[model samples]
Target: MERDRISLTVPTHTDSPAQQVVQYAQNKDPPSRPLQNRLRKTLFIAMPPKKRQSDVVRRKSRQSDVQPGDPIPNRGKRRYRPGTVALREIRRYQNGTDLLLRRLPFSRLVREIAESVRPRGEAMRWQSQAIQALQEAAEAFLVHLFEDTNLCAIHAKRVTIMQKDIQLARRIRGVWGGLG
Candidate 1:
């Protein structure tokens, strides 16, 4: 197994103020060679291993008694908020056994569908279509399920100063003009 490795190293030469300004102007994106490399490696490891020419992950169906709409948890995050729940659901649809994958993001969902029925050509074709449908459903669920609600709700909270200024303003209809 490959171990995690990140080498944080400062540049050998320090840039003077003028050089720093020039470098900043010339390059809008800062260099993070080490960080980027680490990220790429991390993603590679995070995803399931690639087997043969194709990578497939299939979960056998449960007993006839198991109900739909329930999902196995594979959130990989703090599942305290709705956004986190949505994220976990997305991860499930993208990667595991869940009825919600019925909704999903198109391309990613399709790739997964391809993997599901890969062994049988005809079945694979149908699975592809199913995947597309599932992805759309999953994407929809992620978007609406996490928004305009408790978890991802963004309501503006105004700070009001309850000083005499507010009381006086309410009491007076008069403006800054000559007193009426």
Candidate 2:
């Protein structure tokens, strides 16, 4: 039988002549203050003094510059009678008020539903209010499902509802008749 031997190599560090020169350069002190003062005097010049504000001419304030307590000048006049201008204003107000309504409008709901389902395949078109009505219906369905699931869990003599309880609840409610 042959035995395998392993050899270890250790690294030895010795400072070269260039390293010694670098060490000596690092230890050397900076130049004396007299040389620094002479260099600054020769290389740098003093700047001219700035003029005082009182010596310069004062600028008069323009009409465009608004002062404190200045009443804002009205740019446009309001219409008193129901003219074309009044009708346009009324329409703008109605549109703004409609946007502030709590329920999502029919057109916006349809657009949102279309955007959500677009990635499934070719875009499916739906009528206005369809998505909003569908959402309300689904909410009601979930409420009923949760109630039925709670009852199922109670009937099974369990306080905590499990997946099996939900499955049994759905079976009792016949909600997934066509799902299979």
The candidate scoring highest on lDDT is 2
> The CA-based lDDT of model 1 is what?
0.46
- Cα lDDT tens digits for candidate 1, 1-180: 344443333232445545644564565454555542332211112344445433232332334435677676686965486478767876776685444442435556566767785775544444666666666566554444333232222233323333443434434434532122
TM-score of 2: 0.30
Tens-digit lDDT track of model 2 for 1-180:
233332222112324535533543477542334432322111122456566675354333454477879998988977566578767876886566233233556456657767886786576776547665665565556656766777888998986778887788787758553322
TM-score to true structure, per model = 0.19, 0.30
Worst 10-residue lDDT window, candidate 2: 36-45
Candidate 2 overall lDDT versus native = 0.56
Q: Cα miss at 52, model 2 (Å)?
A: 71
Candidates' C-alpha lDDT: 0.46, 0.56
As a TM-score, model 1 comes out at: 0.19
Which candidate ranks first by TM-score, i.e. highest? 2
